[model samples]
Target: MTTQQLHEQILLKKSFLCVGLDVDLTKIPEHLLETEDPIFEFNKVIIDATHDLAIAYKPNTAFYEAYGIKGWLSLQKTINYINEKYPDIFTIADAKRGDIGNTSSMYAKAFFEDLKFDSVTVAPYMGKDSVEPFLAFENKHTIMLALTSNEGAFDFQTLITNGTELYKQVLETSKTWKNSENLMYVVGATKAEYFTEIRKIVPDSFLLVPGVGAQGGSLSEVCKYGMNNKIGLLINSSRAIIYASKGTDFAEKAREEALKMQQEMEEIMSLKFKV
Candidate 1:
């Protein structure tokens, strides 16, 4: 999806919530394990339950990759289902994939062409050459990991070089790449203090923010500094929503949790944009 398509969806839904589909067999309802593909079964209900309450759905690749081929198949089924059923809702493959240029191109093909995800999270540790391969695709996005929500983020991302934090340099340097306009970023909501400065560099680019509910990132602080004129924020909530009640009623409760976040986001956008 193009950036304008994303912005329009957020406006139409009155939401910027991106429900994270980090499906784990251990965490899903016991009832779903009886299905042919437990992971896909779990994801289908989650998508059907929360699609209207959210503008995006992000499937973190690790959860599926851990299960091997079965998991990989499940992940493909989940993305395919969304593409056919909810094309307006943006989808992100939270693969965090980055490697040498040639390998990066393959990873790009796996997610963008074969699986057909709207965006895929790419780690920038390998630098611009590693990432540019993913950016070469048309209308697809390379959501680079910037300031993350993890405790270890300070180890490298915050380190200053040439009088700028490593991540700040990433935001500045990446914009110069070919087709860089297709780039978006992953800014952890837990690092809300940095949003004000981060916005200074890429003010209009959509930020795929993870670390809201289960991670305790304040939604209000994220919107206070994270939102732009187009409401460029996709605050992701994974465990808190998907695992709300691991029972037969799990899907309904997922909607309830997503609705709460979406309602909060709607109110914040109203305050920020004064609709």
Candidate 2:
């Protein structure tokens, strides 16, 4: 989806919530283990229940990759279900892929061409060459890892050079690349205070924000600094919603949890941005 399309969804839904599909068989309800594809079953229920509440859904590739071929198939099914059913709800393959140009092209094909995700999270440690290949795809987004929410992010992302943080440099240098307009950055909500400075640099780019729900990052705080005229922040919730219950009624509970966040997000929109 294009930036305008994403913004329009946010405006229409009065929300910028992105539900994370980080499904784990162990954490899911025991009853689902008997299902043929427990992972996909869990995802389908969550998606069906919360589709209207969230503007986007991010399926972290690791959860599926760990289970091998069946896991991959489940991932494909999950993506296909969302694409066919909720085309306007942006789908993100949180793969964090970064490889050589040729490999990046294949990765792009797997996620964008084959699976058809609206965006994919990418690592910037390998520099512009690794990322530019993903950017080559039309209408697909490259969400670069900037200031992450992880504890170890401080080891490099915040490093100072030439009087600016390393992530700031990444953001500025990235603008010089081709098809940079399709670029978005993964700025964690845990680092909400830094977004004002980030928006000064990337006033128009979308930000795929994790660390909001389960990680204890405050939505109101993130929006205080992050929301642009287009509501550029895609705030995500994973465990807190998907694992809200561990019973047969998981989907129903998931919907309740998602709706709680969606309602909170709507209130935030009305009170803060006047949506």
How close is every model to the real structure, measured as TM-score?
0.99, 0.98
Encode model 1's per-residue lDDT on 75-145: one tens digit a residue: 99999999999999899999999999999999999999999999999998888889999999999999999
Cα lDDT tens digits for candidate 2, 65-126: 99999999999999999999998999999999999888998999989999999999999988
Ten-residue stretch with the least lDDT total in model 1: 266-275
List ranges where model 2 is wrong by over 4 Å: none
Question: Per-prediction count of colliding residue pairs?
Answer: 0, 0
RMSD of 2: 1.0
lDDT of each: 0.93, 0.91
Candidate 1 accuracy as TM-score: 0.99
The numbered model that scores best in lDDT is 1
